[model samples]
Target: MLSPEADAPLRAAAMTWLTVRSNDGADPLPRHELESFHFEGERVPLIDRQRGIRKPAILEAALSIITVYRAEGTTRPYEDGTGSDGLIRYKWRGLDPDHAENRALRVAMERRLPLIWFVGVAPGWFQPVFPVYVAGEEPQLNQFALAVDEVFGLVEPETHLEAQLRRYVERVTKQRLHQPVFRSTVLRAYTGRCAVCALAHRDLLDAAHIVPDSHERGEASVRNGLALCKLHHSAFDNRYLGVTPDLTVHIRQDILEEQDGPTLLHGLQRRHGQKLMVLPGPRSQYPSKELLEITYRRFLEPA
Candidate 1:
């Protein structure tokens, strides 16, 4: 187990989350307390193990959160922390996903228990790792890895391994940082209504990016997104429809002109030039005209 000092943040976060849930009269405790600073929930233990502080040669790391460094330049990746599958490998607190401590995860693929990693970025700065699951390993090549919905890899990354590792970790961190908050912000901005057809079903609503998350100018901000329904979101992504910077809806000319069913005509094509069904408040919180133009222009592009 890690020292009390290093494990403080995760313990606090877990306890706070549990307390908040319990206070709301939801699941009481939400977690089973095994001891002080130790808890269990979601069928896994939230162990707080120090990155390199060995606990007398045996430790529990499965289903836990770990901090990389105790301080700046103090990160101790367990010696022999990486095993390459000739082409790729993974580093998890110097232990691979296949380590004995993580045996349950391997045994129960459906559980998809998440490993929440924390990196001591600087002397007191820590960042949470995106929750990732153990994807299988290349035993012959000795590589183990992680993923979100799909497996991770370094597809022609930086030549320097350290630089590549930094970028890789940052990529996951950025993804984690962007998604939930961006989704929540954009959804709340439009009051959970689909901007195209005014669909008010929260479950049917999604926060769609004006510019995709992969675009260079893309941002995970309220101003760079729209609240959309699943069907319209697919249409918007597939170029069947679009919205102007001024928030006017526009159906593709091809779709508008084509003779089709009511679902295609009354549902979409006829809606061109209509005012957007929803817009965010505070004026300053409104979508960015510039980002809207980027997608709007794409809407006008041929093919």
Candidate 2:
């Protein structure tokens, strides 16, 4: 719920998605900062108001990627110091793994649809979000763990509850009607630097889609994005230019031959042959070559 403790992490994730990756000029959605953002507790659920049924499951929940914390003082040796393990343990709603909602979570994972969010709810009414994954669970004890990493930030309920310091079986489930949030992943992957010119201005850079968002191949992940500035973003989109999987920038001959002031010559035309300015430190986070090849074939080919 947009509490004081949550301000930093929420804003961080929001900045990555809303401000940083929000390049949708036509249908720009609301921009959220720490101070001015909507806050809600709970996951994307299947609710039938008429039937008086409320079954909660996360389905591409708008609040992306939060860290789930264990009840404040409950202890586990393998859980390490963070009140969390590399996995999470949750009880099935019916305690039956075969429940339709339960099965849907598995399907979501297999299909990799509706980018899964690592949401946390503490026994003491606390919650936080982190960029993590759901590694699935077992029927026995519903035992599981998060992919385990440093949490991005903390979010807590405005009305605090005394920490529930006991081991309780969490009802672990996941479901998504849409793909996962790719904006934060792409923006954070580059550490906020433009891939082409290496510009680091937070407001100036964007998580530019290597493939158009409409294409079936275009995923909303870092592997499908490059941190690009407004200028390169426009150029890249209009087919004024493109980058090879090897990270070489290529200028269309027409743009190269355009008769204009120094802006044309020094700006768009001169970028040819230069290597991409910055790539993610982890090779896995680098834009996918196969995806890049698709983009190159689509927009990089000469007219």
lDDT of each: 0.55, 0.48
Clashing pairs in 1: 85-141
Instruction: Tell me model 1's lDDT, rounded to 2 decimals.
Output: 0.55
lDDT of 1 by residue, 1-303 (tens): 444343334434554544453332111111133123333322224333332211212223233443343321233553223223212234333345555534443432344444543333223323343345555544444434555433344422223456566556556544553455466557766877998898998778778889987798886667788889998999999989988878888988888889978888877977888988778766766778999898989989997
Clashes of 2: 21
Candidate 2 ranges with C-alpha deviation above 4 Å? 1-180, 300-303
Worst 10 residues of 2 by lDDT: 169-178
Candidate 2's error at 94, in angstroms?
Answer: 10
What TM-score does prediction 2 earn?
A: 0.47
User: Against the hidden reference, what TM-scores do the models get?
Assistant: 0.51, 0.47
